[model samples]
Target: MNNTEFQAARNRPGVERQSFKKRLSDAKFLLILFAPAMVFYILFEYLPMFGLVIAFKDYNAFKGVWASEWVGFKYFSYFFQNPDFLVLLKNTLLLGFYSILFGFPAPILLALLMNELRSIFFKRFVQTVSYLPHFISNVIMVSMIIMFLSPTSGMINQIVQWFGGDPIYFLSKPEYFRTIYVTSGIWQGVGWGTIIYLAALSSIDPHLYEAAEIDGAGRWKKMWHITLPGIVPVMFILLILNVGSLMSTSFEKVYLLYNPLVYSTADIFSTYTYRVGLLQGNFSYSTAIGMFNGITSFLLLYAANFAAKKIKQVSLW
Candidate 1:
């Protein structure tokens, strides 16, 4: 084709789409590699989302989704009006709040401490020991908690006996539920969480520390001025994510550990949904509650991202 024909082709109405198709063809190999993941998400993640419409409908399995009677937020209203709603909401919020208040900082502190260690062997050992617990399955972790907290034959009780104090029933007590859950969660996750911060710390230029030293800055001063600031962007980005997940608690841990005695403080949206939806077969009610939880999480995430972008010029977006 000559210049006139080339210009006509470029200015064609479908030129952009044709160009996009050409690009896709050129990247066909990459797309082939990515097809499995794309298919998996479409089949599992996105397709299941369509089922969420049951939240607004009565959702009779026999009636089929399309044929279900539209209740139009009836289940949502029911969930809100339920007598246990307030208690469940409070319990869920407190557990999540305690986790953020305690769990989020534990890793940051550990990462900083690990960074200060001059001995590579000792640092690796500490990291290995700390992260090993994260691999322990929730079932095993809960069992360990139960065994440790047992009033009889437990090491904790033996310690109490040695100290001439009564053996405390930790898991059975509603007041201790939040404390145990948050503490155990921190133990399991803190080391793994430090991975991101450690990566950020390594990216800091060694020159910054050397300059601080030349200025007669002490260890603490150097860390405060240089090291911390180097990772502030990463920290704020992570903080935004954590704040967004403030409504979500460890459902598996809570479900495994909680009983009727500790339900006052241990119940959460997931466990509640599991019982009411899966066990009792109240699909609509459970779907509404789950949807509510997801919406709140999204809103919280947006708020946190907005705040971080405004305050620190850092955000996930």
Candidate 2:
């Protein structure tokens, strides 16, 4: 192109690179606002990543991480060969899968239902009650579960007796652990989870609903045609994120609720890693297992994101 055309093209509407000083000055206010979060992330999250070297070494308390003998993949092979590996893997995936299946849709469903509610006061009341469980401490929450499900004098057992049925040990049964864990997670998180969907819902143009009504579309029809499609991108993004964590069951709930009797069904990766690393101080082996979990999670996230982008043109990236 000629200089004239080039000049005209440069003048056309688009971004141009700013001088370093100018760009920094322009973003200074936002940078200042982000300082605290950057510091916190560096200190609490990124700084600790240096310890990943432990996964490769025979970590020793006296010799320290750097001084410890490099063992290559010895610790990793040890974890694979461990007797409990398959059982732990099974439990973790089962719990996480069920939670995603049952728990992920809950917030979306609740938000949609709440949006349908015309009474503002009633909606607020339900939201408040639903979110209350999220703030409760895990220890207290598990304690409450134990109390409610106690075979001897628990309220649930009392109802069972009233129905001429025998009181059963809910927590001890191997078959019941996943159900109890997943259901309790839903109860705790579903309301709080709705908050994001509600925000997404707010961004929908009111005129769409008005236009739908003008077209003689009923509530269900509007939801199906307009509302559902409107929020689908958000739902898919969250679903992909949940898929990425298929190996991570919540450690606190499982550790608190499980016992030897239910270990066959409830022993998961995080809890096993905790017992091996922190309790037993098998640092290298535990680190290897933890690293494996992290790598799998990363792969799952990438796979999910790729699939989402290909199919729906939605992704975290």
Candidate 3:
């Protein structure tokens, strides 16, 4: 029956609601469609959370997870009191803050500019060139950055020397590390990031722009009045996702780019955890650090969602 007929049948004096089995049979196709994603998350995400017990245990490979001796919060307290705690926290927060400050708006601006482009050929070419960098592996990306900024034969240093300036080792200096990392990240991902905003832009009703034009509005006015409002929800959702990861810096890129010389500014929680946990085999200590990072990220996500809901009435929820 159609929805109206179904409702009419339900409203009849002796009619009864459908059984759970009937509902399940009716939704079987959708259930089948959702099965793969449910299975994937169960296997790779939720199932692995059981390993978190190691954060409170003195984990031993020989004893396995459950058999490991209970250490309570020993590792967590040790990390809090460690000499590198403050520095690592500072570096991680600064990198994340700077990335959001600069990196977040980059794709929005690019999407807006691309939307305004009159020539499809030129726009496609620009997008193609921009997206190429994102597909480059992290190892290759870091290697390129190192080579391009090398003091001896690097392109940037060579240009500086040609202008009668000294060759500076960019990656070796602590002060320059964050800038290089954040800027390179923006360049690498901005184009790929624009794809979502562009999709959002396309979904905006074209009639809004037409109506604005009919009222003697120009390109900028249409964008300001219609285009931006249409995409504000998408932007806020992405912002919330970014804030959730504020404490989780890219381990692969940072590990590849940083050395002892730049560790003062480049060492973050993820890299520190890797060294202590995997390299040094201090499993319990590493697990504690990871747990702390995860907890902080969860709190940030909650706070951001709360603030966004209050301020803009837009949130992940």
Candidate 4:
């Protein structure tokens, strides 16, 4: 009866599924375009995932991955029970939270402000200038930050001295790490991030603005009532994605910027994992730490997506 009904549906117009070979032929151009990324993901992403099992093993370099002893969750238990666990957790969360609090809004506010600009030339200039920092090498960017905040000959300290205040080393103090990290992140990413919001803004119908004008709405009112609402779905999507990475701060920037003097506020899971795995040769221990961070990040992402879908009807799905 099911086969007869399926044959009946297939016989009807537009009810038949394409055969595999036909679908493959139809999608050949798209497959060609996607081939490089597919190969790269298979090589670097899917292949490396096999090593995640090392997190559960007493991995040995000479004995190899499969021959290694199975240690179960000992490394994970050790990490959770470690005295510095809370501090590491706190530092990672605070940095990610601060970044979301400050950095997330910077792009939206910038895009809105730029949207209101009357002169195309000036707006383009501001955008070009804002985007330049993102292209700067991390090493160069950190070096520039160090120079600008230098206590003795730095531009910031120079301003402080002009006000008759003492010069303090910003980089050496633990108190300043989160602020500097978040602020620099905003500076580097704000312009680039705005591209999406700007595109969202552009998609908002011009007819809506015209209708608002005819209804006695001013520029501010139209922007408040129309423009902001237009990009809200995009905002929620980005926010949810940001929440997903709360436990995994970028290792390169943090490692470059931090020293032993600022470890209290600067130490995070990625850096700790790097030190344990690469520097100390504790492969299994560090892999466990990384796997733990990955799990927490996944949970955070899922929770955020769930909440966003419930509250705003907007999510990655």
Candidate 5:
């Protein structure tokens, strides 16, 4: 085109293209703000995703990922046909169900209780103490539990003996494994979990509470009518997220707390995968099992999202 025509086009509204320099200038601050997070996500999350291909191959240490021979789904078939699969599935689901049934409500209850506290000093003290356990390392927490519940000489067993009861092997008993694991998780996690609900509660308007009080509503009535209703959306959103991860349990906690005696009840999918893949050095087979797990998780998430949308009109997507 001629210079005159190009000049006319630039002068027209919507005719001129956005200059790269101007666009960059406008987005500089936002780009800077997001750069670190973008880098971290790529490095820690997306980069590792490339390794998932190992699951489809008979990965050899010397041959490496690209050189490994493709084995199709032989490992996955083995996992499905294995006798231990049913036991692992049952244990994982039962533990997860128990956690949801008991552990899910504990945080909500704790948050509600904290919201009701009138004294600022007492409330601060309680929250501070509650959150401490959440920061404790898993190794330290498991060690403390073992020491506290040791049948030979632990404080719990000693107390039971004092009351004319026999010392119970809490860790070794399969029947007690789920109970101990769930309760310990509750104690360690409930307080920190309450922080999210508490933040959601803070976003609620104070006027709602004041209006409820003027209408002859007491603490219980206000909580039931106002506070509970206010947090229902937050509760529902979090519940959806939780349901999406129903298969996952903290592997460290289970592996650390369980012994051979309680493995019948405590062995879950993650621990099982760790044993077969990591300890046994069946890298290809383990990768297949891991891939199966990822696929199952994806399916579960989609199913849960669909159910949520149908039943409550809430969903992740």
Candidate 6:
């Protein structure tokens, strides 16, 4: 049969579809390329899910996960009743919310400013300088923050002394913890975050800008009309992802930067989990807390995605 006749025959109800084996053989090369990622997720991500059962168990190390006695919702109830529960939840939510409020827009603003730079050399230099902080290890970054904010010997204190003002121990002050954490986080991640928006901006049609220029639109007008809209989809996707992880504050950075003095303001779910699970060996309770955190994140993700889809017609899915 000719091409059209063969296509018509294939589209008929009685025609059999291609077998799975046939399709797999046809795309074998592509599947081979994808195999490593699939294996990695299965091994590292999905397999660990089996251990989540420990959250419901007494979780004796000697008895092992499967052999441990199930305690149902005992740990969850214990956590709910704990006096520190509200404090931990409040701190975690406030820190996450502040980080999102400040850190989210910082990179976008930086990218927009970078895009407007007339000198290519200066733009590249600024980008490189900004991105360098992202590569700094959490330990090193926190240490630097401590050194800078030290009341007696720190640069900040030195500057204060030069101005004949009192030196403030910034890290030890509970009121300053959120601001310092959020600002440092922005410094570390802003340049890396700009990468996505910059990519989106690059893909905008050059003709749109040309047309805007011809219509007597200035730089700000063109940016407001063309540049911002061009990146809205990318912005929405990142925002949803950010909102989904709203409860997941950086444990490493917080642990390194905070002390007993700042625990009231700085203690979060992850840090608390670490202290309970590893330090104190209350594995069951820690696992329960971790499970609660995971569930909260999942719900946040779902809600954010749903809202994005309904309001903006944009979503990760």
Candidate 4 global CA lDDT score: 0.93
lDDT against the true structure, per candidate, is: 0.91, 0.91, 0.93, 0.93, 0.87, 0.93
Global lDDT of model 6? 0.93
Candidate 4, residue 72: how far the Cα is off, in Å: 0.6
Candidate 3 C-alpha lDDT tens digits along 1-317 = 89999898788765444555678899999999999999999999899888889999989899999898998999999999999999999999999999999999999999999999999999999888988899999999999999999999999999999999999989889999999999999999999999999999999999998889899999999889899999999999999999999999899999999999999999999999999888999988988988899999999999999999998999988
- For model 5, how does the per-residue alpha-carbon lDDT over 1-317 read when each residue is reduced to its tens digit? 99999898788766444565678889999999999999999999889889888877889999999999988777778889999889988998788878878988898999999999999999889888988899999999999999999999899999999999999989889999999989988999898989988999999999998998889999999999988988877777777667657778789999999989988999988998899888999877776766776777678778877887898787777
Residue lDDT tens for model 1, 67-96: 999999899999999988998899888888
The window of 10 residues in a row where model 1 has the poorest summed lDDT is 242-251
Model 1 CA deviation exceeding 4 Å by range: 1-33
Please give the TM-score that candidate 3 achieves against the real structure. Answer: 0.91
Top candidate by TM-score: 4
TM-score winner, 2 or 3: 2
Candidate scoring better on TM-score of 1 and 4: 4
Worst ten in a row by lDDT for model 4: 12-21
Whole-model lDDT, model 2? 0.91
The deviation in Å at residue 50 for candidate 4 is 0.9
In TM-score terms, candidate 1 sits at: 0.91
lDDT of 6 by residue, 69-157 (tens): 99999999999999999999999999989999999999999999999999999999999998899999999999999889889889989
